[model samples]
Target: MKKLMLMLVSAAALTAHSAMAKDTLTISVYSFAQDAYKKALYDPFEEICDCELVIETGNSVERMAKIEANAADPVIDMAVISSHDALSLAQKGLIAPLDISKLSNHAKLYPAAQDPIGNNMAVGYTFYASSIVYRDDLVKIKSWGDLLGKDLAGQVSLPNITGTQGPLTLMMLDKALNGGSGDFSSVIAKIGEDADDIVTFYSRSSELAQLMNQEEVIAAPLGRFAWSRFKNSPLSFAWAEPEEGQAGGMNVMIMTKGNGNEELAYKLMDYWLSTEVQTRIAEALIDSPANKDVVVSDEVADNLTYGADLINSLNILSPAEIIANRDAWVEQWNAEVIK
Candidate 1:
């Protein structure tokens, strides 16, 4: 009888342990800066929630595909993706509208960060400004039109039309040439006309950085997130404040539809967006804070897309506009820019 009682107690303890282990929240995130994220975010959240974070990291495209493939039964509880990507997922019914009340820090985010994708389907967590980064010693870039001017001629590079900064570059160049119209046909034709003048259409910021460091290219349009790579380079580089102003975009967080982990997901989202965490992430130079309450030193602010004055001044292209016209733009691009 004693032996049987001891066996039953051990079985019950094992079952309880298994039940506790089941408390987990799976998330999909960008592959970059995983170590920093683990230190500043993932580990702390795990400790606070007493739940494991099963992280799946990759580029936005692959992760979105996986989320779609498992739409009927979401493997990811929550994810962070570009606002346009979030809109696409929401359109496909792969993600659900957020319950803002669950996120205490929702009120703390910048107005643009709130309801960025509409219907509260997602919330912005970071903002990036895109502009020209040029070797001030070699050329002067005062306007977006200067990218194709006689001065930059063969020394400059333009972003490939397929990348995030591509449409932004087109938009600004259009503004410079035609009073800020949304139509990019003229821009594409103009770029084609000046194609030989450009060294190459770069697809990655890192690749662009390498070219710049090697003095193979002197100027290019780049997102502020990659500003550090050039700012710290041996060459003298400057972020351009063109007459047309800077183009900007946001990355957002979304909850998977019917993932049965709303409680835990919301918990993590709230914690991630809290002022403390935002400040930490900003200081680490990992992401620019969307929380308006976050404050950092001038030096840190210089390295990030910080402060309301600059954030408000940015001319952001709408996600709806991008989603609606990207296909047409791509077709035109392949025909004229690449061909």
Candidate 2:
């Protein structure tokens, strides 16, 4: 009878353990600085929630495709993607409107970050300034037009039209060339004209960093979030204060529609946006906080997209504009620039 009791007790314990293991939340995020994120945000939240976090990291295109492919049954409970990408998903009805009540930290974010894409479909997590990164000793970057100039010929890298930095670069170049028209046909044609002199149109900031480090690329347009890599390199690099000003945007978080893990997803998102977590992330120089409450050291601030002044100064592109125009931009790019 005692032996039978022991077996039943063990079976119950195993069942409880299985139940705990079943509670997991999956999040899709950009593929960068996972180690820092794991330390600053993921592990702490996992401890608090007593659940496993399945992190799926990739570029926006790949993550978006997965969300769309699994729309009938969402594989990702939540995702951190470009605001425009989230808008695209929302338009497809692949993501659900966020329950703002569930996010305690929602009230603490920047006013602009609050309802960034509207309908509570997404929330901004980080803001980044995109501009030129160039070797100070090799070249002087005065304007967006420098990429097309003969001085930087065969030494400059441009972001591919599909990536986040691509359109921002085009915007700044457009501004520099023709006083900032949203239309980029003229800029595209100009880039195409100088395509032979360009090293390559990079899709990833990390790729641009690699090329720059190797001396294959003397200058490139990149986001400030990716600045730490170039800053720490042995080679001298400078972040240009371009005459057209820096273009910027925010990366946001969104919930996948029909993903039954809404509660856990909300808990994680709330934790990530909290002042404590935002400060930790900012101090680590991992991400620029969208939570206005986050405060970091001045040294840390220098490394990140910190300060309301700088954030306000950024010439941000519209997420809605990007979503509406990306497909046409890609088509034109393939036909003109890539050709």
Candidate 3:
């Protein structure tokens, strides 16, 4: 009778534990990463957990608005967002503080990328750096100064103020030509001088690509991701070595606050941070691996912005500062440059 009772209790606890292991995790990510994520992360993780994955894709503004709207009763478990967006949400207290110790692969991440903003608000996924894309056959633009030439009038493309490229390019050029190193306000003067030559400032990388393909533009500051789509083109990408170096942004993963799905979300975040996973996904997608320990094949490594010295030279901006000043910068941009 005692043996039977013990056996019955063990069986009941096992069933209860099995039931507690939720097999469904919904994640939000950029539309750009949708295909690669589905192929690499979603499929593999689902197979491992014997769970179902529901992926939602959108731009930063739309995704953030969704989270804010659903804060009280959150449906999204985990989100792959920009560090700027992460910082914005963190400031609003919409994201829960993550326990780094709980992550199975925390040690695999780049030391600087672990708690990217220093407040443990978000974890860096990958970084995007800006460079000059010019037609080698048609023009000679090796640095920021070449873009300012009157010969390229009506042929230059630029980033819209709302976009990361716009602000980063502005800062990069300012640090290059003007005496200033960090403050981007000085670069606007250079842009203002070449304003007449500037074509429409693009809000999307697609638009910038189109401009390049159509021969409506000669040179512009573009991200490393854009290079993948333009690999076969006659366009040449030159990493401009400015005094302050290249400017870039880090994409991060965020966990929403007060969500009942913290356990699953935490698990997914850990898996995403795993060096093996990062190496696998980043190589296939041409996105820079966020995990410092991740080692990729030579071909994929060539496609990415890599090498320790190069990465170290990258003057990456603080996502927190960018978000805090985003509105004001946009306003000022419109008032002065965009106008």
Candidate 4:
């Protein structure tokens, strides 16, 4: 009877441990996250763990908002977010602190993607840089200051103030202000008056390609990923080297608090940052990978910021400052720049 009782206890413990070993996980990713999940994430995980992945895709802001809404109960397991949004979620304690040591692949990531800001609340997974794309045939724009004058005046594309493009444009404008030193009130006011000169205030980077192909708009301040289509065209991107240089944001991955899948989340992140997976994702035209150990060929590496040196050189705004002053910046943009 004693032996039987001990055997029963061991059996129960084993069952419990097996139940807890489930590798299947659900991920909340941005809509744009599909390509990466397909090329870099899903198959490798599925092959190794034989576990299914359920993807929940939405905008970064909306995804973070959902995490916030479910903070008390915790519906999400893991998510990808922009660096600023990741910081915001961490500040609010909506995300779980990552157990960095568990992630052996942690040592393989590019330094820029290594949670320089969030500690372990978030980790950089990709690098994206923004610059001006122009038709070499139409305009001769070489500097950010050139944007203000008459060279490509009527055939331009810019982001509308109420959209994501609005913030991106502000970052560029701030740079154009000669590291925030150039007097830009007149330039800002002129944009509002000259709004018509802008062919469209695009909400999506994909639209820039359409407008460019149609010749309705020749130049735009575009994200690196958006340049995939234009890479071989007479239309190409230039750094535009505003006196302050270019500013960029790192895409981040965060584990949601209390979803009962910490290990699975870490494993998914490890897979995503695996050098092989990172190379594949960058090649598939998804965003750049976060793994510094991954070496990319000239093609995938051309337009993206993937390596350590480039990632470190990327000038990004502070999350606290960007979030705190966003409203004021928008207000100033509308009052001074947008009119």
Best by TM-score: 2
Q: Cα-based RMSD of the predictions, in order?
A: 2.9, 1.9, 5.8, 5.7
Give residue 278's error in model 2 in angstroms.
0.4
Please identify model 4 stretches exceeding 4 Å from their true place. Answer: 1-24, 33-36, 160-168, 182-190, 232-244, 333-339
Q: In candidate 3, residue 104 scores what lDDT?
A: 74
Q: Kindly state the number of residue pairs that clash in model 2.
A: 1
Clashes of 3: 0
lDDT of 3 by residue, 92-149 (tens): 8899888887887777777777888667878877866777877767777656666677
Q: Give the lowest summed-lDDT range of ten residues in model 3.
A: 235-244
Angstrom error of the Cα, residue 41, model 2: value is 0.9
lDDT of 1 by residue, 1-339 (tens): 999999999999999988777588999987666788999999999899888999998666678899999999889999998888898899899999999999999999999999998899999999999999999998888999999899889999999876678888999999999998889889999999999999999877767998999999999999887787788788999999999999998989999999999999999999999999999999989889999999999999988899899899898888888888888988988888789
Best by lDDT: 1
Question: Candidate 1's C-alpha lDDT?
Answer: 0.90
Clashing pairs in 2: 175-180
**What are the TM-scores, per candidate, against the unseen true structure?**
0.88, 0.95, 0.84, 0.80
Off by over 4 Å in 2: 1-10, 13-16, 19-22
Score residue 217 of candidate 4 by CA lDDT.
Answer: 81
Model 3 stretches with alpha carbons more than 4 Å out: 1-23, 189-196, 234-244
Looking at model 4, residue 255 earns an lDDT score of 89
Ranking by lDDT: 1, 2, 3, 4
Could you tell me how far off, in angstroms, the CA of residue 231 lies in candidate 1 after the best superposition? 2.3
